[model samples]
Target: MTLSVTPPGTSSGPRSGHRLAVRPTRRVVAPEVRRRRRVQLTWALMVLNVMTFFPGAPHLLPIPGSVGKLIAQGALVGALVMALSVNRPLRVRPSVYVVILMTLAVEALLSSLHAEFLLGALFRACRLFGFALVLWLLTPWWTRRDLLLVRTHLLMLWGIVASVVVGLAVAPGLAMTEDRLGGTLWPIPPTQVGHYSAVAIGLTIVLWMSGLLRRSVALVSVLVCVPVLLLTHTRTALVAVLAGVTLAGISLFTARSRVRKAFAIGLVVFTLGDLTLGSVVTTWLARGQDTAELGALTGRKAVWEAILAQPRSAMEVLFGFGLSNKSFNGLPIDSNWLGTYYDVGLVGCALTVMLVLFVLVAAWFRPQGPHRALALFLVAYCVVASFTESGLSEASPYLLELTLAASLVYSTPTREGPR
Candidate 1:
């Protein structure tokens, strides 16, 4: 046999060709490695996500608000960096909601330029940007929808439990705000704790409906949250939870199937249990006081009046004050819509409304399922809650939940594994 000589760079024989082929294979990651890496990233994201809620935890570090903001921004940036470093094809499909968020962020940045406190404006803008960025980074994980949902719920449960422990340890007396037993971590307002616990309860319902979590576990979770919700004395949280559960219940009941019907029954039972628990808690807490006293809007009307009373030029009316303008009549604006209007003007307010509407419409369009139900409940809850709580404009746990709901609603159903 004549041994034919090959060029230096070219394969000469079968072994040489095999070597060349194996060289490229080195770059191909093993499935085990990929799976391990993905799990690590998912856990990292979960930790970061939970940490975003407790930035004010004194036991963790007695950092100031600005420093906490910086830490959150830094963690998000780091997450984005790690996500980018993953040898996976990133899918960024910006929906209408994403566009609105980006627009609001940019608008806020511009408004910040004219803000009284430039540094504060910058901080607020960074926080908003971080929210958008974190949402975007999270989109990739939606490919593993089941895993994502499970991990999210688990992380949320861990976070709430941790908050309870820390709150008890750090500020046991403060847990009972006035007369109600407000279970929240130190430095977090009871209202916020109620809001977030309600959200967690909502997610638990969604998970149960979707069969991601066991009905028993879900019921227990909801039951646990009821006291936390009631303890905050946050009527808004209760209303929001009721509205969300009602919407979700309608969706669950309307479906013509045995499983869905089972889910509806379970949800109904959970709701009844929650309401009974809430009523007992409320009655016990308000045993000596007039029930009408509990109905007070907590001076939210005064805050709105203060904001409306501010003299604004036409330009300011159209494109209102900056994010740095934190107070109305020396009190923080408690309403999300009012805060957005005060900070970024009418245009921003309009955009915010449109975003909510878009999410609602999107939820309506989603095929009748647990996802649709969850989306509708979340959007409705956020919308109703916004009237009482400053949610969307700020970097709080509520906003995090909103972002997750939005992503879930808008994300396409096709699964694309990392390349």
Candidate 2:
């Protein structure tokens, strides 16, 4: 028997009831749509990750107190999953800032060997390690997707800000204690509420000036966030917001016409505010504190002196007593450098200094853009706030903000000339 061959130019039909195989055409998604999807996914995961760290979140949402530990761990697990899901291999240089943070995490674990509260310190150290690991694991995506990374970060921040506002409206009495705002629902410290508001407001202005966000939106954010910020009566947050926004906006003035116009309008608004609200503002800043208390930096100076005066072993001075409750004799340290030293000692303090300085120097040289402006604002805010509040060397909002800034700096393509 002989097989028949199909002739050239002849249409071939199925033989022996066998169908020809067909390769399906793949659907092509638009670049913008894909970017948006990535950003949204990142935003959701970031919200979960950030919620774990936000001062009052675990105390209120998804369960409170001891049960909150599970939620925090789950969030990190989700972050690890997200980080491992990157579609492509990263080819960027290793981020020095990230390395330093990872080092700090290892140091924290080492320092915790003799902590006063062994369990608490170990738990905190583990969380710090998880945070650093998540950040490092996601570096490939964050470095190439800078725009999406920061946009998602801002969205996470705004979510917290909105929660505080809603909490205030829902229960003014619970939100305000002694005239200070701390959402009754979340029950966060008034200072944390103020921190979120101040950061949101500052970043909104910077993103707006950089044309990343709309003017109307930024204006609305400031209008809403300011009230929450003011109600918290957190003078440190207020000062930091002013300094951060001012420095960030300055970077955009030359490139963005809106910045100059806004600056002029702001000057006018400030002048009128000084004229009409000068006494009120001054009184509020005073917060009923006497000169002696104010001179002592609201009693922080004494705490600093006490910390410094306390004798320490050679190893203790070098490594510290390990992380505690971030307090001294039942009182909060209220200072980043001091707290870092108390928790991790002089070595931790040096690493913390490097963390801030590296970001500061990178933002100084980075090309002017929304990312740089944001980096500038976050770094400046952390710097100002560090002197008055702790958390620079630990898994806190300030640490996250600094890490975000570092990612922005490293993710950006560098120029031949420094800004």
Candidate 3:
């Protein structure tokens, strides 16, 4: 709730031209407005916080990565102050996810006790804990139609998209490395650009089909995001988007829904893609890699084998080697399960498995609706991407997106609003 102080002239003005009124009247703000603002601020803070993950090298800000992270944290603090201005603290749902994430964060903190890079590991744990705390604070708005949070997230994504596009136009060579597009100005990886763009496209299309997003807005989002995604040449994101949308769109096949329009559009896209760029698409997917490299998952197999071959104590196996920039021997461990296992150990891996499984099971029983569609898309994309991308048990965008799906599944609204 918000406080609106009555004007001094009305509340503290002379009364009967004698005694002065001492107290100003307080007016309660609408619950919906308060909730909306709280959710938006909380979500926005989380979005800004994600920026800390990227290294600020050759960045637009021209500052050290640590300094950039501090600036991001400053924004986080500001958003926290605003989010806490409400009348009461929000409560989290009784989700297994709560237990899982708390345990993971605690494990991370404890791992820092024995880690080589003490500060790095501790800060990593803090980021996870902070996000979990924010999720708890956002419980009040976890509803089917919590469009306030969704709109804020979409706006943030659009800003990212626009920034990358600007970077492309301003510095094409820096943005495009070997024909793979990245956010040169912002310093995002090509895979990250593709992932975000794929998410925006999939969510926009699904939301539009569900009648929650305007046709024009959705069209623009897809038209803008799809090109960015394609330019990144991220096969994982491309396949994930197709899989997610196709699976989520199943509910719209009903007679009352706009299935025909969606199907027609899909058909057109597929036909055009096949006729116009089938060979080009194949070459892009190849990425100039040979059969051996392709089969080895771009040399990821060697890294995975090396990670597994490393000798570790039983304690290390249970808790892990602790977070070290999500890398090992100067190579990135891109697989989610392997990365989580290495950073947080077998226990973290078990928790990550439980988290994803719980959501998938819960979504399986959810009735047909926009909420289920989103849940399906988010989970499906993450599941597909996990084999290649890390962040299932860490403070990254994948985990954040999965947390959103968990909220949709666990939220218990007393009354159903219009779709």
lDDT values for all models:
0.67, 0.79, 0.78
lDDT of 3 by residue, 1-419 (tens): 98877875676345676875479879888776665666677777787777653673334546667766786766556666655564254444566877887888888778767888888888788777777766665655566465555567778888888988998888888788778888866678889889889988888987887888888898889889999998999999999999988878875567325756778887999999999999998898999999998999998899899999989999999999887677778888889989888888999898899989988888778877777887888899999999998988877788888888887776554332211
By TM-score, the candidates rank as 3, 2, 1
**Runs in model 1 lying further than 4 Å from the true structure:** 1-70, 87-91, 147-150, 169-171, 180-186, 256-296
The predicted structure with the larger TM-score, 1 or 2, is 2
**What is the C-alpha lDDT profile of model 2 across 115-189, one tens digit per residue?**
888999998888788878767755554554336666676677777778877777777776776888875545467
- In model 3, the clashing pairs are none
Q: List per-candidate RMSD values in Å.
A: 8.1, 6.9, 7.2
Model 3 error, position 197 (Å): 0.6
User: Which wins on TM-score, candidate 1 or candidate 3?
Assistant: 3
Candidate 1 lDDT tens digits, 186-250? 34556666776787787777667666678788777778777677666777878887798778767
User: Which 10-residue span in candidate 3 carries the lowest summed lDDT?
Assistant: 410-419
TM-score per candidate, in order?
0.77, 0.84, 0.86
Worst 10 residues of 2 by lDDT: 410-419
lDDT of 3: 0.78
